[model samples]
Target: MFTYEISPVFILMEEVVLRKMHSIIGWPEEDGDGIFCPGNNTMSNLYSVLLARFHLFPAVKTHGMSVIPRLALFTSEHSHYSIKKSAAVLGIGSENVIVIRRDERGKMISSELNSSIVAGLVPFYVSATAGTTVCGTFDPLNEIVDICEHHGLWIQNDAQWAALLLRTNQEVIHYHNRLQRAMCCSQGLLQECNQLCAEYLFQPDKHYDVSYDTGDKRIQCGRHIDVFKLAFEAQINHCLENAEYLYYKLKRTDFKLVFKGKVNKVNFFCCVFSNPATQREDVDFLIDEIACLACEL
Candidate 1:
């Protein structure tokens, strides 16, 4: 029988570079925490801040959102519904969670966001996507951060698609793993990653001095530690590095802009459209032509 290792929710440790990375990213370096959730995926991470915010009043745990005034939250219309789910579960109600508009490429329209913020509602939090679901798009983090900072709003970036970097060469050069060989994420994603780390700094280990333990910086409470931590990081890096090549290759094709933007450093782009001038009738003819060509073979 294949034994299942039932590890705890999280391995209680923080990356040694967690704090230093935070400082460089421009986070406060004082008020942040990372956790590793055993079964926790994106929603758990989203729900965490809801719990923390309620804890701010300390009575909300017992009283719920009823104790506070009508608070509001914000997320992109194209974002994963987890934002709304978090709001509903937190007792904030889905209606109060404002869904911001996105531009043609699925990126959040920052100007529309700014307009919404001043629409007389007490907006407290704004959750942005690092890579959106449908188009694999990215929100404008720099613009979002500026708005959030100016409005005293808490900003959460859902980077489940691009959670952290994986310096493969330096970290996992000696390790061997199937998945680890995938992404060594390259340059394009650096901007998004840096902004997230800086704006949402995660530095909550008392030791805080310097240790390579990065387990604590995630949102999952009971985290499971990867024995080959550096190796795992390297693997992700490797994966992204390879993925960038595909982006380049695909961009070389004359595909239509299904999701227009620079090659995403995180998720793969799904280019599903052809040139605007291409006719549907031509597509049908091409399909038949391909069928005939296959038969000829």
Candidate 2:
């Protein structure tokens, strides 16, 4: 049987980075209490850490109160398997997960959610998937946020594949309109780099300054490089744009746009062609040809 290992140093580093980021982002609301450390990266570890934190504070141990051991973790059936998995990991019983039913088109059934919340199962947290994998449908975020607030539940927005909300103009207009259009993408990337530096820049209670002494809170020390190298030719590669153009061209024939956005990705429906008149191999060859030609340019 495989067992979880405890690494004091590694856990300390991870917690420090998480806390520092929380401070920088002003999230999870730092209350001056010491943070709990769980020495693993699996979904189980996440659940365990959260439960362990609740243990330290008995105020959250009641039914209607803050220390409720009972957690009604909410997510749609279309959401990732991790939701139910995390519940099981925390020993809350998978039945406690409370999977919200979806509509005919697969968006979460809001009425069912409303009924359930009114019944008072006492929800603790919700994980909303910004992009459902099988069909890629985004749930109504504003509506969901309102529901969560009414029930006093925390929300974790999952955006692994659908975090491109940074590209919209109406949203960015609140900060700066024409100027943001000029440098938003570049500025966003640079900001990510700067935030990382702030976390790992050899300061106490941060990453780079932890010593490797006996019983010290670190597994490894000395210089180690973690760098991501992108190809110099990445800019010249217009494969994504070419593919998108081809997608739009095909859509002009008979496809119906279902969900339209550049963030979570655009979804469309195309009727099945009766005759297999279009050569699949030829289409592949044409796309390859277009990519090669664009690269050469």
lDDT of 2 by residue, 1-297 (tens): 000122444445534543443343334433311222222123322433243324333344343233454557777888777667766755566798788887655677766776777454556766665556555566666667677777766555543224223221112111111111011111122222212222333344534334321122211222121101111123223333343455676566443445443322454433221122444554556656765786799
- lDDT per residue (tens digit) for residues 113-161 in model 1: 8888875656787877765666767688878878888887766666545
lDDT of each: 0.51, 0.43
Q: Estimate each model's TM-score.
A: 0.58, 0.47
Clashes within 3 Å, all models in order: 33, 8
Error of 2 at 153 (Å): 0.8
